[model samples]
Target: MAAIAALSQNERTLRYVIDLPISSTEYNIWKPLFKLFLSVKDDESTICGRILQSLTRRESDNSQISSYWSSMLENGLLSTLIQIFSLSKNDDALTSAFLIFLNLLNEVPQIKNDLDTIKNCFSSMLKHTRSTNNQILTLLGRVLSCLSTDKLLIDSMVEQGLIETLMILIDKQRSSQIIYPYFDCLANVIGKSYEYQRKFIYSKNFLLLIVRSYLQDYDLNLSLSVIRFIRQLVKNNEELQNILAHYGVCEHLLGALSASSKELQQVSIEAIQALSHKNQKVQQILLREHALEQLLNLLERTNMSTLQVAIVCTLWTLCENNPLQKRDVATKIGVRKLISFYTIKSDEHLLVVTDAINELAKCAASINMNIQEEINHAQGIPYLIRLLKSDNEMLVLSVLKNLQLITCAPGFIANRKNQEIIVKNDGIKLLVALMMHAKCDIIQVESAQSLACIALSNNQCSTLIESTLDFSYSHLVDLMHSNDVNVQLKASNALATFVYNNSRVQLFLKNHYQFSFDYFQKFLQNNNESIRCITAFQVVVFCGLINEQKQSVNTAVGCGILMDILRTSQIDDAKSAAAECVARLAHMKSGVPQAIIAVNVIDYLCNLFSSSNDTTIGNASVALGFLSHIPEGRRKLLNRSQTSSIRYFKVLSNNIERSRAAPLSDYEKEQSSTNIMNFYLPNIRQKV
Candidate 1:
């Protein structure tokens, strides 16, 4: 019985080794064929082709064939095969040899060392491409496609004018089988290499050829290949995208969205996305082509998650910074569809979905209040708030940012409702938790920023935030001491916004959490310019919200720190913030004005009146106005040497006149202008 088993195994091995139609698990069965091919002395023997066919089959059978590569190279099998390819006239022999070479290029890492020997065969392949045999042309194109993977071989192919040859063949070849391989080869050669890209672009009518080929093709496979080529060609190349847009490539890509094949539609969508990225001309062209209408239709019809994601991404690129398109998307209920992406629970899908929602929210927040309302009415808020519990930090950050945009865009009056919705959903608790306990500093910082946005000018949200069990003023104060400057800045800003004009919350913090000016001194003197700027602004908010009689808080954030900022800080925003803080302190009238005057801040304040920053100039005028209220500040202002006190007063008075004429409403400007006219000018006139 053992002898019979051995006999059966031997028969199977002979069948596999002799190129019969059989299979075996025996290792290195192709070695016997390699030995037979090597023993053949005649270069014209058909045995070479047979052995090459066996090798190709073995390579396909096992991808882990690199173990035999060293022995094959030692036996000069690759050189011998290339020799047969160059000299053979039989199409079968040529096709077999080309397949083996293609396989070698893919599998053997050591093949790159022998690139010069292989490069000598490109001329022979180019010659055979002119043959009327479709099989020869297809195999030649495949061989070139495989060779195009290496930079050295790509340079060789370009130097030998393979691109020009392939383009010529593409123009002449009417067979889709032949043309598909040529397009594949060209795409491979031009894969992200700037030199090849430039050559393709500069070539006369090359892009036109590609667009025409893609738009006119009937075969789905050929169209897919050409569109993929177009995708690769336009990736990150805005110049090529614009040129192709002029050639009507975008219109054709949009037309492809209606294809029956899902794969063709997917590739076509990807191609359109690559073309329209950051290219406003292409984006406008796509919009005019009814891209939004078709994409929305596809989004509704496609159950394939990847295709849906691609369609959503294409919509995002088209609508980015294009308000006309965004408004159009909103008109079509596109925001509702975008909100639906949150239902997908895969982290990959959620990350993309959250990013799209965030960007759409940002765009809508800037110009369209109705869109923000649309997102809210679509139940976007609860979906976003629920994502806050995700273990993925990036997804949470994206949701937080989207929530912030919805609640705090500058002109978005509907944010009041969004803020209320967030609070209703317990988003405040989740945000506070992230701000206090998230491991990533960026997440912590973004969480704090989102919280600040929620609390901005909304007393209801502020009240809820102040009462959340896990949240406290101490948490914010602790975050302020973080080693990261951004963390410190964001935490300080959140604290300030939490307390801004919310006197109840402010009182609660002071009475329960020991919130004081002492917590801010370190930030006031921080070397980071942004920290100093935001810290000073926080102090401004703190002083403005408190009673004027709280001199200890006013004096604790010393006039000298602000004076030093005005004297030494280079950033105009920081200087403006510092000046504003000084104005807040001086308005207290608890001898802080005299202290500012005593510190000689009057000279710095007067000097800042001529600054380039409008905020700085306005805040400086207000600080001087407050200083002029006190008798001591009045004496110092009227005694300046370089510019007359009356001249400074005239500049202040002119600023007030300009404020009234300016179109935008500035509350600080209105209040300061009123105060200057009502009180400071009378004192200045009496002193003058």
Candidate 2:
């Protein structure tokens, strides 16, 4: 059998396997061809690849070969194969062994306990790593890889110290033939436990070792391999940051930030971004090291791919922590450079440009020194306005959010002259259209935020913003309960800001007709912290109407439910807002507060006067003051001993003391403009 196997493996017959007829009964004639492969005299990789290729292709559905192979293995054939696999010096023998194992392992349970005997055959081969022949290790690694996904098989191999062996191979000096098999082994083991892989790769001290080796390595190929491994580590932000924090990575990364190769700079910047997010110390270190300037420089000169990645990372690290970071970027550059960069670049380059612009808008929210100046100078608003018509979901989101912020900036309204710029070029209508048409939750949430920003300036903007309020209410309400936490926060913010004005509130109630008070009632009882908190607050604000026209019986009943949500256990802001609504309702008409008491709202307001969270506390005070304005509301409070009003007054007094004592960050001051305009706008506009 060995001599016949040897006879068929000579150079002349390899062509025959490729040319063999699909139906040839001679297929079985090649069943023992692997034994011939084990004896071949060959140095060519192609011969090895070809023989394995023929075996794999033929073995595809060849159950006869499988059965025959199984019968051969069931006898003493396993020992001769083990001897050939161990003793053969030719790559062809190793390739044949790999193919045979691949076929056999597919029917792994058939090998059953005998599989251990076969695997034991490998214990001797692994010892051959000490030999000058590394192909044995490579081939063994490949054989193990084929079985790596089988938990039972891998667990057995691991018990025999296979992971330690594979790591040694991986940690060895680079050899082209050895590296691929090591990567394959790594991929297999990582697939076993991603967390375990991450721990080793991103360990605080070990990551520096990898980065230092990568930086000092003279070989570009080796450097790229190390980078690819590090890139996997960067996927875990906290892990990557913790690793980066162990060294002066900010300066190290900033030095490399300007590498002429775009790929190198991208990887370095990504690692820095990951680090910043992982540790606030990294962020402070970056800030101290002028990391933002280096990043901005990178943004200015970076290629499209690099710039997009840099912008995204910068935004994630900077804007995620403080809206002020976004504001600073906007105020410094005015978004003119960034917007013009996007406008002039080809559509293919637009993605990176869009990322920069989106981050700029988020940071710049209503903070530009001259909103109109920046918008006009960059030609930013018009380009973004046009993007409202874009088919791409992300583009629409970017455009909408920036435009929202731009339109909301103080003194952003266009006169007849700037009207073409503001309304036409920037396309306010398209943004309004998105309230109905956008399908993505992010786009919808951002669109709502945009609408809120646009409504910030004046009654004119409000009238236009109010037109979309019904559509906004429908989606905003749904998103307030979204599974995505960010969407829920953003939508809650949008509703709180936009719904504050009487025009939008009236428009939403009348048109969108928030008839499903029951849905909101259920949401208020939800276990989600943000949902319950924001929903409680927003429902109360919704109930308080300044110029609210009389509602139909159904709308009035919905209003009663709003009062109930406020009066429920742990009403917090909801209770305070409900009390304010009772005041507004009674003052608007006597019938409203009478209807509110029917829902038992006074007890709820009394409970919230002592609540934490400045919003609930302040609203409670204001609600008590408003209640003191209404005869029946005042009587209800007085009948409850008037201590509710006194407690609220105390809460208000304490809030003022805290406000005076607590200093705001630049971002806080920046964010304050939005809150100020949101809550105190009508009075401020009236005074103006």
TM-score of each: 0.59, 0.52
* Top candidate (TM-score): 1
201 Cα displacement, candidate 1 (Å): 2.2
Compared with the true structure, what per-residue lDDT tens digits does model 1 show for residues 1-688? 2122222334344444445433334444444444444343444344555544554455456456634455456657676666666666766666766777776777674586686666566676687777787877887777776676666777777777788888888878868777786777787778838778777678648678777764687787689889888888888888898988998888788888888999989999999988999988888888888888899899888888778878877877888775445545644546777777767544555765666655455431211133467778889889889889988887887888888778764221226778888888888888888887888877876887788778866666666776776766677778777887667777777776666545666776667654455566677767776466567656655664345437456554555567778898777767777776675555442355566688887888887866765446666765666566566676676666324546556656554333223232132343344444323344545466
lDDT of 2 by residue, 92-194 (tens): 5565555556556665445644656565665545554544556555566556656665555655665666656755555563464455444445445554555
**How much does each candidate deviate from the true structure in C-alpha RMSD?**
12.8, 13.6
What does candidate 1 score in Cα RMSD to the true structure? 12.8
Given candidate 2, what's the lDDT at residue 623? 43
- The candidate that achieves the highest lDDT relative to the unseen native structure: 1
Error of 1 at 415 (Å): 9.9
Off by over 4 Å in 2: 1-29, 39-131, 134-163, 170-193, 198-214, 237-240, 247-255, 286-290, 311-326, 329-337, 340-373, 376-400, 411-449, 452-688
On the 0 to 100 scale, the lDDT of residue 53 in model 1 is 51
